[model samples]
Target: MTEKPVLDSRAKVIIAACEMIGENPASTLSVRTVAARAGVSMGSLRHHFPTQRALRDAVLRTIYDVATSDDEVIYDRSVAPRERLVHCLRQILAPQVGDEARRAWTTVFDAFIATEPTDETRAAYLTMAAEGTRRMEHWLTVLDEEGALVPGDVRQHANFLNAVVNGVSIERALPTETSVLERETATLYQAVDAVLRAVDQ
Candidate 1:
C-alpha cells in the first residue's frame, strides 16, 4: 500500500501566504485564513512559525529564493567575468516575474507600508534588507578578489549598486505609459554598465 504524501508545514504556510498576497493584500492576513488555505491546522502552522513575524519572514525569504534562482545559471566560471557581472546585474533589475507576480509583490509592499508601524514587522523587513545588501557586498568582494574591481571601497560600491537596484524596483511598481517604460528600461542597462565601468579595471 502507498503511504499518504507528507506535506511540509512551513512550505504550506509560505505558499498559502503568497497566494493570499496575490488575492487580497488589502485584507489583514490572519492565522486562520492561512491555515485554511494551506489545508493545515492552525497548530501545524504555529508549529513551524511560532509567531506572525516568523511567518512573514519565511514568506519574504521564499520570495527571494524564487527571484534569485537565475543566479545559479550566471555562476558558471567558464563565462567571462565582465559578462557574468553584466548578466547578474540584469538579472537583479529584471527578475523573471510575470505581470501577475509583479502585482502580487507590489501589493505586499503597499500593505507593509500602509500598516501602522510595528516593531516585529519593521525588524523583519530591515533584517531582510540588510541581508540583501550583504549579499551584494559579497558579490563585489568576489569580483575584487578576482582582480576585476577597481582599487576602491567595495562596500561603498555595493551600497551604490543596491540603491540603484532598489530605485529600479520602485520604478517598476509605478504605473507608466509604454513610452516611459521604454525609456526607464533602457536606463537599467545603462545603470548597470556605468557601475561596472566604474568598478571594473
Candidate 2:
C-alpha cells in the first residue's frame, strides 16, 4: 500500500499565514513573514505556493474558513428553525457588549477587500459568501417545507439578510457612539427576524 503523505505540515503553514493575514491584510505580506509565523522555511512556503499571488489566494480561502464557521457550534436539530436562524445570525455577527469582536472582524474583512489576487481568489471569495447565504437559504427552505416563512424568494432574502449582518460588522468599525451601535444591532436583528417571519408566513 502507498504511504500517507504529511498533510498536517502544509495545513499548519496555511493556518498560520491566514491568522497573520487576518491580523493585517493591507500590510505587505512576504513569504518570509508567513514562513516565520508558520515556523517553516521560505522554501517550504514556496514549495506549497509557487507565487505570492497563489499564497495570498490560499490565505484568502483560509481566512474565510477561520471566520464565520459553524464548526464551533453544536447544532441541535431539536431547536426550531426560527431559533436556529437567530442563533446563526448572532454567531455571524459575534458581537459583544463592547465592539472588540466587530473591530477584529473589520480588520480581516478590510484586508480581504484590499488584497490583490488572481481571478481565482476573487471567485473563491464570492463562492464562500454564496455558500454562507445558501446555508441560510437552506434553513429557510426547511422552515417553509415544515410550514414555518411567508415564502417568495428564500435565497434572495437569505442573501439580503447575510448582507445586512455583514454590513453591521463593517459599520461597527466606524468611530461611533454606543447609541449608534445599539441602533445598528437592533436593525440587524430586526432585518433577520423580518425575513424569517416573512418567508415563514
Candidate 3:
C-alpha cells in the first residue's frame, strides 16, 4: 500500500496561507494570523518565511501553480490562433462579472483602497498585479511563438492587454444598461487583434 506523505511545518504554513488567500484574495496576510491558522508558533512561521513578503510570494506562487496546472487550452493548436488567444484572455475576465464582481471590488476597496495603506498592503497589491501581468505575458509569449503576433515587446503587449481587461472588468462591476458581455467580447477581440499579425487576424 502507498503511504500518504506527511506535511512538515513549512508545508503547513503554506497551506494555511493559501487557504486564507482562497477565502479572501484581497485580505492582508499578517504573520500572526497565518501562524495561528497554520497551528504553528510565530517563531516557526518566521523560520520558514522570514518576512510577510516572503510568505505572500510563496502563497501566490502556490496558487498560480495549482491554477495553471490543467490549462491545456493555451496549447491546443486546433483552434485558430486568434480565437485561441481570445479564449485564453477571456478566462482572466470571466470571474469579474455582475454581482460577484461588485462584491470582489468591494472587498478590494475595503482591503487595499479604503484603508490607510501600509507598506505591507502596498506590497501585497503590487505582487498580485505583477502576477496578473506575468500570466498575460505567458499567454502572449505562446501566441508569439505560434507566429500569430506582430513584432512588438511582449511585456508591453501583455501590460496593455492586462490594463484593457482590468478596465473592462471594473466596468462590468458597475451599473450598465447595455449588454456588458457583448461589449466585453468585442473589447477582448479588439485587444487581441491589435497584437496579432494581419494574416492571423
Candidate 4:
C-alpha cells in the first residue's frame, strides 16, 4: 500500500489559501478563514505566513505555478509561431467566457468596484493583474527568441496584447445578439498578426 503524503503547516496553509482563492478570486483571505480551512491554529498559520500580504503572495505564486505547469506549447517551436501565440492568448480568454465570465465580473465589481477597496484588496487585485502581464511577456519573449515577433519592447507588446484580450474578455461577458467566438478569434489573430512577423519573413 502507498503511504499518504505528508504536508507541513506552511504547505497546508498555502493550499488552504489557494483553495479559497480558487473558490472566489475576490474573496478576502483572512487569517481566521485560512487557518480554519487548513485545520491549523491561528498561531501556526501566522508562524508560516506572518502577514496577509505574505499569505496572498504565496497563494498567487502557487497558482501561477499550477497554471504554467502544462505550458509546453509556449516553447514548442514545431507549431507555426502565429498559431501557437494565438492559442496561448486564447487560453487567457477561455476562462472569461459565458455565464462564468459574467459571474466573475460581478464578483469583481462587488469586491473592488462597487465600494472603496481596502489596501489589501487593492494590492491583491494589482498583483493578480501584474502576474497576468508577466505571463503575456513570457509568451512574447519566446516568439522574439524564435525571430517570429516584430522588433519592439517585449513589455509594450505584451501590454498591448493583454489589453486586447481584456477588452475581448469583458465583451464576452456582455449580452450580444450573436455569438462572439468568431469575432473574438478574428480580433485575436489581428492582434497576433500585428506583433508577429509573417511566416515567410
lDDT of each: 0.66, 0.65, 0.83, 0.85
Best by lDDT: 4
Assess every candidate by TM-score.
0.66, 0.58, 0.85, 0.87
- Give candidates' CA RMSD values in order: 4.4, 6.4, 2.7, 2.2
lDDT per residue, candidate 2, 93-190, as tens digits?
66333457565665556556656655655654555566567566766676667656656788878878878877776666666775975687578657
lDDT of 3 by residue, 35-67 (tens): 999999999999999988888888887776566
Q: After superposition, how far is residue 79 of candidate 4 from its true place, in Å?
A: 0.6
Clash pairs, model 2 backbone: 148-200, 149-199, 149-200, 149-201, 150-198, 150-199, 150-200, 150-201
Winner on lDDT (1 vs 4) = 4
Once fitted onto the true fold, the runs of candidate 3 whose alpha carbons sit more than 4 angstroms away are 1-8, 66-70
Model 4 lDDT vs. the true structure?
0.85
Per-residue lDDT tens digits of candidate 4, residues 1-201?
A: 999899999989998899888779797799999999999999999898888888887788778767655568878778788888888887777655688888878888888899999887898898787888888898898889989999999999999998998888888889975858889889999999999987723
